[model samples]
Every structure is written in C-alpha cells, then in structure tokens.
Target: MTTDLVAAVDIGGTKVAGALVDGTGDLLHRVQGPTRARESAENVLRAVTDVVTQLTEHELWHRVVAVGIGSAGPVDARNGTVSPVNIPAWREFPLVEGVRKTTGALPINLVGDGAAIAAGEHWTGAARGRSNALCMVVSTGVGGGLIVDGRLRPGPTGNAGHIGHISVDFNGDLCPCGGRGCVERIASGTNIARYALAAGWRPAEPDGDVTAAGVAAAAAAGDPIALAAYDRSARALAAGIAATATLVEIETVVVGGGVSQAGEVLFGPLRRALGEFATLPFVRNLEVAPAQLGTDAGLVGAAAACWSDPDTFLIRGEAGN
Candidate 1:
C-alpha cells in the first residue's frame, strides 16, 4: 500500500522550499534553503536544486509521482521558464528543465506563485468547495490567482488574475511594474506604511517602528493618519476586488499574507469600502474571508497543480489519491 505523492517546490526571493505532499494535501517531508537572490543565475538554481536533493534523500521519495514548481512570477508554464521580479538574475530561466534534471521522467507542472496559492486554497483551504473564487496575498507585494467554474485558471503565461497590477486609481501613483495606479502600488504592505509615513504618522516608540504592522497598531489605537492610510489601501483593494467580481462573478475572495494579518484593522475598512464599490446586483453578494493554511499554501498549492489536468486545469482525482 504505497501512497502517491507530489514533490512540491516553492521558489521565492528569500528562500527555496521543497516538500513531499500526499494526495490529501498533507506535507510529509520538507526541506529548504536560502535563495541567493543577488547571486548569479547558477547560484539560485543551485539553491533550488539543493532543496530538491534534500527531498530526494527522504525515505518516502520513492512514492513521489510528479513534481510541481511554483515560482515567483512572471512564469511561462507553456515554455517552462520563470523570471521572478525580485530575483534579477533569472530572466526567463529554464526552471522546469532545471528541476527535471533531478526528478527525471516525472510529469512536471509549473505555475506562478499566485496561481499556486489559488490552487491550494481551492483544493483544500479557504476556497474549498467554491466553484469560483479569487485568492490574494497582500504582503511586500500584492498577487492573486483565480478559480473559474471550479478550475484553476493560470492563463497561458501563468500570470492571470494578477489583480495587484490592475489600475484601481487612474490618477494614483506610478507602480514599479510600469503601471500607473495599480492596486499593489496603493494596497501592498510597503505602500500602506509609505502612505502612513507620508501623512505624518509616527510610531509611539522612540525607535520609530514604521511598518505596515506598526501602522496597523496605530490604526487600532485611533491614529488619524494610520487609519487614513489603511482606509486608502482598503478602498483600493475594494475597487480591485469589486472590479474582479463584476467581471468574473466570483463568489469569494480569500485574502492572506502579512498585511492581511492586520485582522479588523484591514478587513473592517475593506468590508465598508467594498460596499461602496461592489454595488452591482450581481456582485453585491461577494464574500471576502481570511485564508487558511498560512505559509504552507505555496507548497500545498504547488502539489495541487500537479494533480490538476494539464489541459483543463481542474482537479482530476480524489484528495490524496
């Protein structure tokens, strides 16, 4: 009675993590290494491969049936390449081919990190049992993925549902992604802190702790500047989410990541702003909830991608089969 498993890799700017996930979305064994983001391309590749090597050393490696890689976007699932924004050295790096060198003959699936998170949530976390949903991460940057008609839609380039870059404010600031007034430019953790600082918000501490978390604390304490910053971010997010719901008819939006941990500080205002933007009858019932699975969504979602039909992007089998 050998169990089937997927070898999952989560590649980010800070680390390269690997795990063996069973069909039930449980991580059985894990390994990780720091991402040499500033180093040469080969160094970063080596870091990813090192994690794979460690996974292969696990006793259950023999049960692995497929390999799934969820890399920071933008990823080319069709071409099996990745060009992560934070990892400047990898411009269209052959990530699938690189990992294949170690896994050999196993089916390899590639998707953007956002899509991976969506797959995970849809498969077993917050979006489970929902036919259509949007999942987003609002941390240093905002990223998202979509589930349409009960299937993960990574798009051809694996960058669909990138709600962050969608312009919620045409007259807002320019974003690093070369887009003007993108949601991420206003709603990301970095931007939230920046907005607060620019508006004369200061930490109560003499050491000057000026982060999104710090601003969240101030907002909780009724600091006008901090509350305004979060309100602006919430408005931008609400606009983006409303636009997505109006376009795609999603029933739910599962939000996660560092900024989302602000709890009511972010969600309370977000719900209020959503009422102002999502006024259309068809989209008025949209629900937003916090994401479950925490940090493991990346790994679990990568494995979920492997179990999905390559053509339809739908889950093809029972959980943990």
Candidate 2:
C-alpha cells in the first residue's frame, strides 16, 4: 500500500510552487513563496531550495523519487539553465544544480513552462492518448509546447516550443525577441488590450477596464470596438495554429492561460478562421479546447515526466533522505 512520490517545482514570474507529487500526478504537501524577481538569481534559487527542503523534511515524503522543475522561458533544460526574458535575475542561472543540491543529488528533470503544460496534458489531461497535440498558453503572454508522434520534442535546448515567437505577420508589431509581428505580441492578453486601447475605447468608470478579459466581455456584449480587438487577436492566433498544424498535423490544440478565460468569445472566431485558412485537409480537425490543469499543470507535468524515465527516478535520493 506504499505510494510513489516525486517533488515538482513550478517557477513563475510572481511565485514559485513546490509540492510532493504522487505517482498518480496528484500534488501532496504543496507550498508556495514569492519569486522575488528583483532579487539576485542566487536568492531565487535559494527560495526554490527552501521549498524543496520543506517537502523533503516532511514525515510522509519518503516515497518521493525525483525532482522535476518547470520554469519561465527561455529555459535551457538540457543544460539545466534558465534565461527567462521577464526575470532578469535568471539569465544563465544553474537551476538544475540548485535543485539537485537541495534534494541531495536527486535526479532533477526540467523543461520550459510551456513544455511542462504539454506534458501535463499528455500525461493525464485533455491531450491524453493523442498522437499530436499542442499545450498552449494565451495569458499575459502566449506560449506553447509541441508533441510529435506522442513524444515531447525538447529540441536543442528544451525550448523548441517557442510557438508564440513565430511571426504571424512580418509587417506586424515588433516583438521582444527582436522579431516583427509574432503571434504572441498580437494574441497575448497584453497585446489584446493594447490593441483595444489604440482603437479609442475609454472606460466610463474610474478603475478602468482595459484588459483582454474585459475586452472579450465587451465583444460578447456586442461592443464593436472590443469585437474588433478580439477579432484581430483571434485571427492572428488562428493563423498561428494553422501554420503549426501545417507542420505537425496536430489533432488537437489545448489552450490555457489568463486570456483563454474568454472561452467561446475567443475560440469561436478562431475556429472559423482556422477552418478557412488551414490548407492541409488533415489538419482541418484540429480541435481547440481549454487546458484542464490550470496553473498546476506545470507541477503535474513534472510528475508525469517521472513515468517516462525510470532510471533517473531510481537515482533520486531525496525520497530516501
């Protein structure tokens, strides 16, 4: 009746979540702490270590086997480093070693936050049992992971799923990656609101509702300006999805993130546009659905990854210590 365990860590711009994950991918002994973005990279790593320490010290944590970490991009999971564009402290930070040190030489698995989301879906969520699918996030920013032939493609530096960075329009807006018109810049929540603001929408109330969610609500309520904003964003996203389908022939697209809260308002038109633009007939059925795991997807995916490699699982020493 003993249970299997794994320590899963999710690092984001605002917070770091760590928990003991069972073989079933459910979290146990979960805890949280601030990411302290302005702090030094060492301080952030130290915070991650503190959380892992708590998990390892817990009385019932013995069954935990290894550690799997998901962090903000652009992560170099292969080399165990992170270079998140938003968090300046993490440039070339050695996060893997930090985890390993905290776990007493436990094997630590790492991947980009987007890839972790994909792994979570593939393991037990919406993308389960699918041969080709994408786990995408359209939150403050847009990002995603690719699964090809039912396998996670951790390309080159384990950052292969920079789908958001791909150009949706060459003559479109400039991107943080020094590119022009990336799908993320146009479709992300940030961009959605930015476009809405430029379209001459002013809030009547003092607080002001100038976010993508509010815009989506307005669009649903028949606001022409808001609808136009959503329309523009949805079209760009649809094009990106179609382009992805053209290459991978994906069967489903699982989208999550803050902006995805718009649901049908965002997806309906996106589906229509994808249908019209997707050239390959095989990709016509690329079903778009909401992500099931929400923010916990990263932790769940980390635990799920444990099932993929048993050798490393056995080497993890934290569960024993």
User: Best candidate, lDDT-wise?
Assistant: 1
Cα error, candidate 1, residue 178 (Å):
1.5
Candidate 1, 78-163: lDDT as tens digits:
99999887789999899989988988767789998889999999999999999999999888788899999999999988888988
lDDT of 2 by residue, 156-262 (tens): 67677668888989997788767899998899898889988898865546686888877887888888888888888888888888888888788899988888889
Model 2: pairs clashing at backbone N, Cα or C within 3 Å: 5-64
How does model 2 score by TM-score?
0.91
lDDT of 2 at 186: 93
- Candidate 2 root-mean-square deviation in Å: 2.6
Clash totals in order: 2, 1
Q: After superposition, how far is residue 290 of candidate 1 from its true place, in Å?
A: 0.3
